[model samples]
Target: MRSYKAKSVTSIQLPPRERRETVLTEAGHNVFNLAADDVFIDLLTDSGTGAMSDDQWAAVVRGDEAYAGSRSFKRFRETVADVMGFDRVVPTHQGRGAENVLFGALLDDGDVVLNNTHFDTTRAHVTNQGAIAADCPAETDLTTDTVGTFAGNFSTDRGWDAVEEHGQDAVSAVVLTITNNSAAGQPVSMANIRETAAFATEIDATFVIDACRFAENAQFIKQRDPEYADTPLSEIAREQLRPADAITMSGKKDALANIGGFTAVRDAALFEQCKQRAILYEGFPTYGGLAGRDLEAMATGLREAVQPPYVAERIEQVATLGDLLRDRDIPIVTPTGGHAVYIDAAALFPDIPADQYPGQRLVCELYREGGVRTVELGSFAFPGTNRPELVRLALPRRTYWHEHLEHIAETAARVRDRRDEYSGLEIVWEPPMEELRHFSAELEPVA
Candidate 1:
């Protein structure tokens, strides 16, 4: 494999000269509350945090800024059709915006939205519409001690049963989030996707995909599925989307673009509804919450993201970090996810009680001790005890070389050394009742 180096230049100071106390005070108790200037290594999210290639920069310069039917939109649509086989495309500012439009278009007051794992924004959008956001996560998700090949799979039987349990009339859509983010970034099998689609079809339900990480999921399919071992990444992706009636995407993750997303569907009526909602809420069809330059950049980045070398490199980078953690006998979700390395907080800190939120504590500690930023996917991300306490180190696409991963791994070793001394966290301030508390929840160390 060829080694890729970042061509961009920006100097950053290393570890803060001050002690941990000073840095902790600057960071507050919430990772989200911390400013980017204070953090040295950011692992907080893969969303809109990636580096763009030279080709993408050139495309951005060539964008045509037309009010309607812009050339940039045309290029973006063609790329989507080639990658996903969707007949119609509606652009959105980001993934959540796409979800809001589609869920509003399909979901009713009492409708049900089902997914393998509905990540934060998706859950907020679904529930905001007065619809039920239910998860039919695979049985493997509950087995937190072990890992599996497809832990992200939505059980076909469970999904059907959920529909039966909720009544078919109440079901709005059977959704699958490719590379289930909330479930430790696990990949869904092509077989499962096809089967789930078939089951949804049999029950007269719409099959939608939250395909934010479609490229990474496709790479996993190629490597894990013997039948697709020789298949190209684009074809693997095309087949993956074939099972879905529509797809909602955050171009930031897979496309290697900073900001862009779209909703694609084969249903003309549904697309029209999305269009109306989009224009009303977002902007015109041709430039929906994105500049012509963003559209052009997304078009270019999407094509590059699926290249054999790029896909291989992206997955390998994540595995490299996960492997380093495993080498130290650290607890992590084995088989390593495509986009991030998830540290099992429950295993890492058995002394720290779950109610105090060990996952959130680790997130804060990683930032305070090592100047690395990460997010908690456990009780902090989802307000429930059923989910495993996980701290996600999400790697940005085409950003951060192996040296950066080494820095993170070394930091993890440092944190592990003092794991026993690590205390818990308590929420000092939060809304009386908020949609997602993690975004704004204030915290303090429990002495």
Candidate 2:
């Protein structure tokens, strides 16, 4: 049972089947393009979609809106330092903003950034700076039936090979995304983190962690890694960051806030450089691009995020949903993930080739069948990439309950039963940017 009660509620209505079908066609078959009011259960993303706690709301009211050196910024900085063990915290409007600031300052033309697997925006930001974004995922089978505790680990072997392939001097940074988002929200092991950090040191590259879901990742460590079974979430979180030279976070995820993120560093010189970049792109260093209230809420959320009860319940909820789908014989990535349940769209639609976008087809069918909105993270999201075709049902923190999850599972079962009726999707028009075309690309049923 939850330790808290709902203080407020929002009304949601499921649009009729005909209306949903029309909306899908009008939105170019892209869930990202769907209007909010037209959907029943919105699961397109967990970013900035979670509901805040009462404490966060109280902090928001006490926020100091000063232009620079605000009280809220100091509190936020202190909280981040306390929880993440970083002295310098520069806020941003969101996670991508932190990425922009960090990459803008650290990356140059012909540079390379390596990660376990770069989510859509992270890869885009690295490539946007004219740098090569390389993925070094651990050698593990990510098929639906393959189960593991820490499949999100980075392959040090692959990282070393990449460094050699593109001269060591060309490598600028090695990033590890905690609870690897692109790899079905799996958690990275502490042992792997230490090994990857050592590898980064050997290569003389900055060890950066994309820590959007840091707390959840830490909780996973406590549960899965026997060494940390007795450790507190806060200490685990600190240990997770201790190896990183710097971190870029999207506060939207673990921070439990609506908006705000930060790029934190241990080196004062590098911190100054990131601050200067923040000034140029975001607002002043203190406020970055967010309101003071956002900083206050983020601070409170950071504290709340690491508490044992909150993290355990949050992770368990996701696992519950995964179990629901699995009981129905749905092909889902196992042992489920921290924030979302990844459905193997390729397995679901074996006849639909990668070029036809099976993942996107599933996304469309789920919406049309049951008013549940989801996003594709396969060929459509990462064009030409030889990765699993997945549809992520990202659950927002504290926003859903058992019934909501059941509805989602029932919806998936309904669609799966009539899977033969669904076909593949073909992109009719896409943007010039090849990396992020899934966000706005227009598509249609492949006839």
Candidate 3:
């Protein structure tokens, strides 16, 4: 149920370039043999469920052993362990599911979760558990004080303040998002993560990494840091991950080829307890609601996720998009970390009132005009109402190439030119169609 308001909006009628039509697949309609140069990138969706190698399919086709009897759980456990060096691993259906099971299991009433910034789902999970999610203003001091919005935002001092104000018992954990999505795809340096993790440990609280884009974060760090110039990407990621007591990953983005998520913990007791909750919400402790196929793809994807070339390629593509957007003075979060291009709508559309946040305005306008869809990162995603607005353009994982970027850039240029026209009405949304979910914004888009 979407709410709609009758407002005249600008329209862009450019024909989207077509790349490839099809790729052979046993799953038929379920998979798209996406050419590397497709124009319409699916940013609003998850990583596609493309078909995997014949051997991968065979592994999935043989599920029983993969799930329980054979050291399937152990193998997956060791996979997580070898990389993260965590004592135990507990697989779940997806990242949010892992968040739900883990938070629900750990948080009681009045606990607090502190993070540099938060993803929508993570905040909702904390709130749902009757816990408070607080942000410690972090600033990424890459250079001097001229800190970028995305960087230097995760500060250790603020984290200390949070725990000092709210006693250790009141603070359940400090969760760090690798590529802090809400903060414009900005990644925390290994130094920041380590300091934050150390601070959390000092307060006797659990440290968790929302490692949805761990590999991307690793690339950003390596490219940005001189000290890490010689270190391998895998080693850097493992080091950042080592400080956290547990990690929650979205398989769709970084681990599995398709959709799924898993959580791992270093403490034996915590791992056992989290696994027990997984049985309740997820599936059995062994498989945890994933199909045989998903488990197999995930196994392969996890291995590929750490490969330097695989990680580097995706980061490069996203960086390309970011560079293009920035070149046009489109108000993008420059020095883009990895994975996405974040447009600072407020800066771009300064005249638009905060009450009618221009970012939301642009999102609606772009969709109506070019049939391009994107998620709005604004107050709606935050716990409290009236937060700053931002528009996030999540690059489709390993999809599209130079030509696809041209279309996106063309669309953006058109949108920029027509920004004034869309700003005319200053359309303010009425009550939302859906109750405020975390990151998702369902609004009334009327013509």
In terms of TM-score, which candidate is stronger, 1 or 2? 2
User: TM-score of model 3 relative to the true fold?
Assistant: 0.83
TM-scores vs. true structure, each candidate: 0.97, 0.99, 0.83
Error of 3 at 124 (Å): 0.3
Candidate 1 lDDT by residue in tens digits, 1-447: 545677896665556637545656655577787767777889999999988989999999999999899999999999888877886999999888899889889888988888898888888898889998888888884323557888899987788788889998888799999999888888999999998898789878899999989989999999988999999899998899998999999989888899989999889999999999999877997789899999998889888878989989889989999998877767898788899999998888899998888999888878767789899988877886368889999998877777888889888888888899988888778864355888878878788
For model 1, the stretches where C-alpha displacement exceeds 4 angstroms are 1-3, 15-20, 141-146, 432-435
Best by TM-score: 2
Which of 2 and 3 is the better model by TM-score?
2
C-alpha RMSD by candidate, in order: 1.6, 0.7, 9.0
**Residues 186-213, candidate 2, lDDT per residue (tens digit)?**
9999999999999999999999999999
- Local error of candidate 3 at residue 16 (angstroms): 9.5
lDDT of 1 at 238: 85
Q: Where does candidate 2 stray beyond 4 Å?
A: none
- The count of residue-pair clashes in candidate 3 stands at 12
The top-ranked prediction according to lDDT is 2
lDDT of 2 at 409: 95
